[model samples]
Target: MMMKKTVCMGLILCGMAFGTTAQTRGSLGQSDPKAKVVLDNVSKKFKSLKSVIANFVLKVEGANNSVSDSKKGSVYLKGAKYKVVMGDQEIISDNKTSWTYAKDVNEVTINNVDQSGNSMTPAKIFTNFYDKDFLYRLNGETTEKGKVLQNIELTPTDKSKTFFKVLVDVDKKNQTLARMKVFEKNGNRYTYEISSFTPNGAVTDDMFTFDAKKHPGVEVVDLR
Candidate 1:
């Protein structure tokens, strides 16, 4: 249960790695044009890449501004396929089937990918998700680590969503996503900082799947 929750959160962070180019819905009357321009540039940049490999740091904070957990992870994305590795957990999907692997137990769970809901996926990172799901505005700029970052604040359109707001920091010079912070209603905050990103990385379809033959005595739980 804990691992599943962690993977879900990690996927959400990964989904926001690239902005979208879709048109904003009419409900987003407050959306900022300037922010959309920045996001559009990011979208165009990511769309030109054939694949991406990114290293990131995830930080979870409690309501009292105390850090609860921190983990470093890497994600590989190519078209509709993705693989995420963090500590002892890995989530991989090939746009059809999904696998969740736990290294500590040497167990892997398999299931079908459900694209009917608002569930975030690495492929959605390139879709126009923000235009339909969020109302955003430009929140000014700040200098971080000697780089000028344009801050954009986003509010979800659906009131029932678990998260209330998301803060995105875009690298002004490169027009790439730099950081993202999600604020939940329960006072839990999740932050993802992109440490490094490599576009057009060498990746193959087999890398997105698990091979039990490689792991001796591995257990497979087919939940699909």
Candidate 2:
């Protein structure tokens, strides 16, 4: 359960790595002007902020539209580093190495970061996902609790991709991301909603790395 949840979280950051190569993506068209404008604004917002901390709810649904499970978690993202906490599991990475801690099992796994640039991390997405893999367009607008939201649809350029589409909701007034929904070809839907967002939160470097010494009696499996 912990591993699956961590992978789901990682998928959001590594969407650009799936399926096709950059050369094969040449035939794709430019992003729709409207969508480009909105995403550009969002990228700028992320750049101006020092860091980000958010609480989120993740919902997983089956092909029949029935909820398989739901979990609440918090994430801290700062540049190429991030830490995710859900239930008794935590995934921490510093763009160089990663650590997965499963408290219930009293175990930790360590591995080196995949430096191939084939995968996009959360930090990479915040900085520049608009330039690759997807062609996006405005999906119209809707109001939530009286707040206006601009919905944008992103279609993967490669039809062979596991997930065909992604929907992003941006707050029109604040120019911040509100929610994201990913639809998978396997009939699984992943919905991530941000319940709280704090920009420029105080973050330290050590927070992104894990130290097994801090947790005595934990088994360490080093895969590096």
Candidate that would win on TM-score: 2
> Relative to the unseen true structure, what is the C-alpha lDDT of residue 195 in candidate 2, on a scale of 0 to 100?
85
**Model 2 alpha-carbon drift over 4 Å, by segment:** 1-6, 12-20, 23-28
TM-score of each: 0.88, 0.89
- Tens digit per residue, CA lDDT, model 2, 9-58: 56544642443244355577667889889988888898788799878888
User: How well does candidate 1 score on lDDT at residue 12?
Assistant: 53
Scored against the true structure, residue 31 in model 2 reaches a CA lDDT of 74
**Which one wins on lDDT?**
2
Q: lDDT, candidate 2, residue 112?
A: 93
